[model samples]
Target chain A: MDLLEVKDLKTYFYTYEGTVKALEGVSFSVGNRKTMGLVGETGCGKSVTALSITRLIPDPPGKIIAGSVLFKKKDLLKVSDEEIRAIRGKDISMIFQEPKSALNPVYTIGDQIAENVLLHDEDLKNLSKKEKKREAWAKSIEALRVVGIAEPERIARSYPHELSGGMCQRSMIALAMVCNPSLLIADEPTTALDVTIQAQILELMKDLIKKFDSSVLLITHNLGVVAETCDDVAVMYAGKIIEKGNVREVFKEPLHPYTKGLMEAIPSVEKRKEALKSIPGSVPNLINPPSGCRFHPRCPYVKEICKEKEPELFDGRVACWLYGGAR
Target chain B: MKLRDYIARRLLLLIPTIIGVTLVTFLLTNLMPGNPVRLLLGERAASPETIAALEAQYGLDRPLYIRYFVYLRNLFMGDLGMAIHTPFPVSTEIMARLPATIELGVTALVLATIVGIAVGIISAVRSNRLSDHVSRVFALTGVSMPVFWLGLMLLLLFYYRLGWLPGMGRLSVSIGLEHITGLHTIDAILTGNLTAFVDAVKHLILPAFCLSWLEMAMIMRITRSSMLEVIRQDYIRTARSKGLRERVVIYRHALRNAMIPTITIVGLSVGALLGGAVLTETVFAWPGIGSFMVESISFKDIPVVLGITVVLAFANIFSNLIVDILYGVLDPRVRYG
Candidate 1:
């Protein structure tokens, strides 16, 4: 059975403009210990998909219209708030994008990390004050050690505001992975980082995956990062995943027209002076997206059928509409 | 600037600011339409020679600027000069009255802080519950009712109508004045005179309530709103998700941050409380600085009035400086600069 399966995930944001269909009929799955990279353009429901899984959708403006995120053999949508909270940072921890803003400024990094351990560890119940403090100390240090922070003892005393951005990000990851969660959702974790720092963080995450023996759902708009770290890839355009397959297969075949366009757009060091390929038009408005395929407007292989009826993801899908139809 | 530097700068700025305050207060008190001599003369006695000699004696016969110079000289030398008709130094009169005002102010502040913070935290914690609604209504009534009117109503209801408490004064004038520290309550405690203590506390209840009600309401509203805003931050969610319980989230995490703005308001309002206590002092006949200012105004004793204004301004400036210093302590991100 798949470790995490999202079936027809639909998260809509109610705005004064209109109910933005952020994630419409989105489906994907991540296997145990398999890193799945979710690639998409900005505002294409990528973050919303991750937020929906955790049920962190902000109220009033955002709502999960429909979805079933099956994690550990249970639909997350059906779980009560208390249960979901238990699952969070314990069963499935998430690493947010901006480290600086994500961590509370007032708290020491030690306290923030100890929160996960304190919340999940049953032994902590009715713990003596001394015992609890000792446990907290051990957990905080252990988390810091795994995240590559030397002198964990001294660093634990430091506050979030005192730490550097990279240090803060590492601390956040340390907190998330402290529980050794089965699945890690890294939503654009490296986007806020510099390119060199991004590579370092990517390597660190990859190392953490091996160390923790957990699967990762790497959400990013960067195809290059996907190539480096992801094993399986999902290409999302507008509000739907246009194509998906093993990373090597998807990169080699360049199946979807949109996928092919994204690949062609990357500047290769090998190519001496090839002019970068630019997609013709902007992404369609999500409030009133085009009737059929969201990418068809910009698809080089756009056909009459592509504009009329949306093509579902076919087996080992390719750009050709001939395959998108009934086998 | 470091927090220290910012505070020092503010304190330094206060010197000139207070001097300016002294000037304005001095001028304004003198500028009032009524004449102190006429008020003192009781509407019956009048002689031009008497008026001229009294004017010369008090130096009111001199130019306004000359009078200001002498006033400043006497003020700097710590002589608040003398009351227009009396030989008693204005400083002595103020010193005598100071304890009464301080007693009333301290009691009122303590009452305000305790009742306001209690109502605020309760309202915030139980938002929309019976306690919250009752407190909200209490705050609304407190804010809307004028302090003088509140005092009168309270005096009538509690003293006249209910006969539950004394209506006025710090202590019964029938009890001979006892000296040490001047606060009747403290002196009673020192002397182990439990009866005096009870009498003093009885005398304090109505006037203190009159002084504190509006301030209490203001604090409650501020604290409630700040707490609400703090409770919504992402850290609050993080704290709750840690399963630390609602008390930890509300009291520990949210209340700490919420207190930053509340502290600022509290400081400024302390100064405002002193200013607004005039009517409370008057209605209760408390003989505090507020009542003293009213009397001085009625007598048109500009020097005494101006002297009190300057002291009040210093208190305000000093409180604000303390508040600015507290802001840094509460939020480290708020640097001196």
Candidate 2:
């Protein structure tokens, strides 16, 4: 069974100019111990999907207007705030893109990691304060060690500023995984690192998730990273999931024209081409997106029906009129 | 550098700063048209001999450089010179009144800090809401209104019209307490004189609030904006996603990061506080160094004025030093060198 399944997730931001429909009918699922890559261009609601699942969108400006996030057979969107908060960090944890900025500057890395353990580990509740600290500290160091951080004890005592970007990201991973969460949502976790550091972080995350038996929802704009690390892939276009399938299958045979465009845009070392094919138009303004298919304006195979009626995910895999639809 | 070396370096800088302040005050006071010797002998100007003797005694007969050198020498020897009108050492006079001013200033700062931070957090958390609007207006009124006007208005209402409080002075007339720290409240508490403690607090309420109003507004505005900035940071998001309570996310994670700006404003406001305290003390008729300094300035009592200026300058420098230390504490990136 899937560990997390989000259906019809609609998140909007009420701003001064107008309502920004950031996420429109975003749906996907992460199965047990499976790493699903949510890939899209910038501002395509990849991060919003992660936040909506955890209910972490800043209110007033943004709200999940419609959604059902079923995790372990329970709808997370319908859960009480207290229930959602309890599930966050304990059952499901998240790591963000900017490793340095994502960690609080004032706190030691070890203190931050230990704090997560102390907050979520129920068995530590009955222990004495000293014992709890000792246990949490030990667990925090162990998490760091497991994430391939050398000298976990020393790194734990250091503040975020003292650490390199790679070290900080390792510590962030340690912080998120200290409680051994079942589901880990990593939102562009390696986007802020150097190219070499990026590979290391991706490799470390892959190895650690396997060791912990945790399912990952990896959100990134880097299709290369997705191809290397993800088991499944979901392609989003202007806040809607246009195509999804096993990574190999989607890479081998991209069904939607938008997915085909994205694949073509990448610089391939294996198949050298004269020039990379680019998409025709920019992403539509989400405030007042195209009425039908979000990608129809940029789709090479755009038809009258594609412009008039929004396409549904046919066969639970692709969304396009070119596929089997009301013809 | 080590913290001890940093503190030592800051203390060494204070010496040059104090000398510069004293030199400017000395030059300006001596260059003025009024004669210190003549001012001393008000009606006795009929006798030139008495004037010369007084001038000689006061060392005004010496050249400007020599007199300044003498003043500096005496200053190092803990002698701030004698006040012409009061016939008392300026140091003694200041020492007598310093505690009252310290008590008032410290009380006002503490009150302003606590209320300002609380109000700012509430306003930021409820941004664009009614409470935020109300606080913004309240903060504007506090900042724009003059200190003396606020003091008078508060006194007129609570003292004259409603008579709910003892509106002036350091203590009520009927309350007699031992003077240990010279701060009536502390002394009363130290002596276990509950009646005196209560009366002293009642007397302090109006002036302290009046003195704090402007600073409170400034601190509130800064804290609100700083908190607004901090709550948007990625770290705060991480804190929230850690399954910690909302209150913990705000107070522990956000507030600490937000305080650097607030501390900066607080440190910078010491000058405003000292200046405002003079107006507050005068309006309330509170017996503090402020009223004493006002009298000294009017009488052109150069020594007393110089003494107060030196004290105020030192206070400002000391507060800035404290702000630097606080910055290091709040953000680990700040390293002393």
Candidate 3:
């Protein structure tokens, strides 16, 4: 069974200029113990989707208009705030892109990690304050060790600024996995790191996932990362999932033109390219998105009909007219 | 960047600043019209012998530079010199009055900080809501109103109209409690005089509140903007994503980071409050260094004016130093060399 399923999720920002449909009808799922890579360009509502699942989007300006996010056979959207909060660190955890900024500067790494462990670990709740602190400290250091941080004890006691970017990212992972969460949502976790460090973090995440048995929803614009780590891929454009399938199937035969454009845009290391192919237009303005397909303006295979009506997702492939509704 | 070394270095840096402050104040006061000897003798006394003797006695007959050196030496010896009008030592008079000013200043600071931070946090958290709007309006009115006008209005309302508080002075005339700390409230408490303590507090409320209004507004505005900026930071979002309680996310994650700048403003406001107290003290006839300085400035009491200036300058520098140390405490990125 799917570990999580989001159906017809619609989130909008009531901004001053106009209503920004940040996430309009976004839908996908991550299978049990599977890594689903949500791929998109900047401002493609990938992060918004993740925030919506956790109900962390700031209200007033941001509102979840419609959706059902089902996790472990329970509708998360319908759950009470208390219920969702209980499930957050225990059942679902998240790691962000900017590692340095993601960690609180004032707190020691151990204090931050221990906080999560103490919050979700029911057995630790009943212990005396001193005992709980001691246990949390030990568990936090263990988590640091599991993420391959050398000198976990020292690193755990250090502040975020005292650590390097890679170390901070590793610590962030440690914080996410400290509670042994069932689902891990990593939003471009390596986007802000050096290429070498990015590769190391990706490897660490893959290894830790196997050890912890936690499903991951990795959100990134890096297709290479998806190819390396994710079992399934979902391509989002202008607040909607335009294409999704098994990573191999999608990468091998990108059904949608938008996905094809993204795939071609990835510069090849073996074959020296004159200039990488980039999609024609930028992401559509969500405040006033395109009437039909969001990618139609940038799609090479755009037809007159593509501008008239939006396509619906068919089968397990894409929501594009070229496939004539996937089989 | 050891904390002890940093503190020692900051202390050492104050010597030159204090020297410079004294030097400038001494020179300026000396350069002003009216001789100290003449001011002491009065215009009606035309006897040159008496004037010369007085000038010689006070060492004012020495050359300007020599007199400046003499003054500096005396200052270093902890002698603030005699007041031209009162014949009392300037330091003694200041010592008597310093506690009152400090009591007012400290009370105003504590009140401003507590109220400002609370209001600012509420405004930021409820941004664009009714409470935010109302607080913003209150902040605006506070900034725009002059301290003297506010002081009088408060006095008229609370003292004259309601008659719930004493109109002026540190304590009621009938309550002659022995002075312990010189600060009426503390002295009253020290002497176990509850009536005097309550009376002293009643007298303090109007002036302190009047003095705090502008600073409170400044602090509130700065804190609100700072908090607004911090709450938008990626870390705040990460804190929420961790499933930490909203209170923890706001206070622990956002407020601490926001406090660095707010602390700086609070430190700056201390200097501003000291300067502002002159007007506040005059309006309320509060027996503090502020009113003493005003009286000394008007009477051309150079020694008293210079003494007060030195004290104020030191107060400003020390507060700023404290703020810097606090910055180090709040943000680990700040390292003192």
Candidates in order have lDDT scores of: 0.83, 0.90, 0.90
The top-ranked prediction according to DockQ is 2
Q: Is the docking of candidate 2 incorrect, acceptable, medium or high quality?
A: high
Q: For residues A30-88, write the lDDT of model 3, one tens digit per residue.
A: 99999999999999999999999999898978999998999999998899888988888
Kindly report the docking quality category of candidate 1.
incorrect
Residue pairs of candidate 3 with colliding backbone atoms: none
**Stretches of candidate 1 exceeding 4 Å from the true structure:** A122-127, A150-154, A269-277, A280-289, A296-300, A304-308, A316-322, B1-81, B85-251, B279-287, B335-337
How do all models score by TM-score?
Answer: 0.78, 0.96, 0.96
Candidate 2 wrong stretches, greater than 4 Å: A269-273, B1-15, B31-33, B43-53, B61-69
How does model 2 score on DockQ? Answer: 0.82
> Of models 1 and 2, which has the larger TM-score?
2
Model 3 misplaced stretches (Cα beyond 4 Å): A270-273, A325-327, B45-50
Give per-residue lDDT, candidate 3, residue B274: 99
Give the alpha carbon lDDT tens digit for every residue of B27-64 in model 1.
88787887776776677888988888877877878998
Error of 2 at B8 (Å): 4.8
Give the top-scoring candidate (TM-score).
Answer: 3
